[model samples]
Target: MAERLPAGRLVAAQFAACAANHVLPAGIGASAVNLRFLTRCGLSTARSATALAVKAAAGGLVRLGLAGVLLLAWPQTPRLSTTIPRNSLAIPVVGCIAVAALAVALSRPLRHRVGRVARRVLTDVRAAHGRRSRVCALWGGCLGFALLHAAVLIAVVRALDVTVPAGHVLLAYLLASGAAVLLPTPGGLGSLDAALVLTLTAAGAPGSAALSAVIGYRLLTGWLPLLPGLLVLALLARRSVL
Candidate 1:
């Protein structure tokens, strides 16, 4: 934001948004809250949206980069096995591309909006790269975010006395989390649990241990902060910070 905001309020806003995220699907709640906070802090809607886009893009790239690096360094790490034919996979991929192309071709407003957003994102990316502090904050925050989540899973695994290696646990978390994005469930509810269990089990942890890890992870990440998060949300609302 160009207009300076109080750091305390900014932190509160983030806490409130994190709590709000689990109540809605695919983080819509968090995005809406952040967008509102940015606007309240005096940014235009387009700029706020661009900022969010940059953040999301950075986080996604970091996850992908980490997974790639881990896979390369530890080639023995288990990968998700699928029996689906390679040829069959192309059908959905091509269909998605075709559908997107057709929609863009036929919808004038959608095309204009997409073009505008693309231009804004490019401009913001260049501007962000020029600022060393901005670059550090963006990538560092994303990397830290991913690592913290992985640490939680690792802690859970260790607590349960499971025999999975830390590298395998981290790799499994990254892959499962990346896959969970496709489902768009609230806090990745069912989708994350299923993917995590599968990935952990595939990584050679026993089925029982993998399931326990998922439960423990969910309890920490989801159920634990919920009430306090809601309380913080209420406080923010009362203080008119949101």
Candidate 2:
């Protein structure tokens, strides 16, 4: 983060990483590309990985925070319960917590590893927060990106003449994006599409319209950038920048 990296190369690396994301689950492809790029720019591998972890943590936290705020503002929104049935969500949630706790308690090595990773991530988070520039760049970028994606989904819904409220659409998009983390599909391909359509439908959108909106969103966000991203990736590779 302290190094003077070339702005053009940094942008190129991000473009290439987005293209790479379609092949790897979750965001492994992008993370690997960013890690390599940072190391190439003279950062240590450990620092580069920490920077990525911090960025990811910021993104996740921002999504959850925005959703929470929205829910608080519009308590009557039906976006959440439609995704998971009312009165039926508690069992699985509690069961997961119990199972995770039991496993951690039973496994010493796992506990130690978890503790080490947690501490490292916490240290990285703290260090990033200590720097005002890093804090602004990290959280602001994450927040802006999440809002832009939500706005896209809303626009798609409106263009299709869906009747769902903008707040509801925003909340639905956030919830679907959060849920998609569990599936870890490449670039959230099938999982996000399914979750978003389901949520949108539950929020009073017609099923057909919801599906169309999701498809349109994917085309704009995923497919459109893919070819250009790949070209950038190839060029970067040829230049030894990737």
Candidate 3:
């Protein structure tokens, strides 16, 4: 799809989309902007939106599964605190169920209002699925990206002069990232930083080192890219590509 546009323009659009996540609440704005950009890149609106949703869902599942495996394999890992927050996990699950139930109850009314939109999305996903190669590529990219993300964190650990094993760093990163998703902050922001510091510290790194590593990781991955991304975004927008 990107081959349809100038390479620089495509890159710019992507950078803009990513930057949107940081400033927007919970990434809703970023997701919407990315979907629109995808459509502008030649995908149908429904296909673009569905593809994003599918990729996100796949990535989430992969992270959760990886986190579970890490926890199970290292069952003796130190507990960060003696007492867990009351209903911490249960609250989100219950809230999701309540929201789902409410949606179901309002389904008739919703259908009347947005039936066309829903049907269009379903049709697009079905059509996209028929292209097996594309679906496979999408999932492959998602999984690959997840691994690379963890690897970056592992590098951050090393850069901090932390002697923790690479495997431990990877596991801590995976678990922390998975936990961060439960927080409602955009791009996980403060929540992700806290999770990473705590998880790394719990994994045996010195507390100061863990905190420093988290800060450095975020600087490299998040802050450093912001200006260039915004510049690219503006360049692309001026050319009418986004």
Q: Candidate 3: TM-score?
A: 0.82
lDDT tens readout by residue for model 2, 1-242: 43457889999999999999999998998998888888888888877887887788789889878977988888876546457543343466688889988999999999998798778767767776778887788889999999999999999989998888898899889888877776789999998999899888878898899999999999999999999999998898888886
Candidate 1 C-alpha lDDT tens digits along 140-218:
9999999999999999999999998898889888888877776788888898899899889988889999999999999
Clash counts for all predictions: 0, 0, 0
The residue-level lDDT of candidate 1 at 223 comes to 91
Off by over 4 Å in 2: 2-4, 85-123
Deviation from truth (RMSD, Å), model 2: 3.1
Alpha-carbon RMSD to native, per candidate: 2.8, 3.1, 3.4
- Which regions of candidate 3 deviate over 4 angstroms? 1-10, 42-46, 78-90, 111-123
Each model's lDDT comes to: 0.83, 0.85, 0.73
The residue pairs found clashing in candidate 3 are none
Q: After superposition, how far is residue 115 of candidate 1 from its true place, in Å?
A: 2.9
Using lDDT as the measure, the top candidate is 2
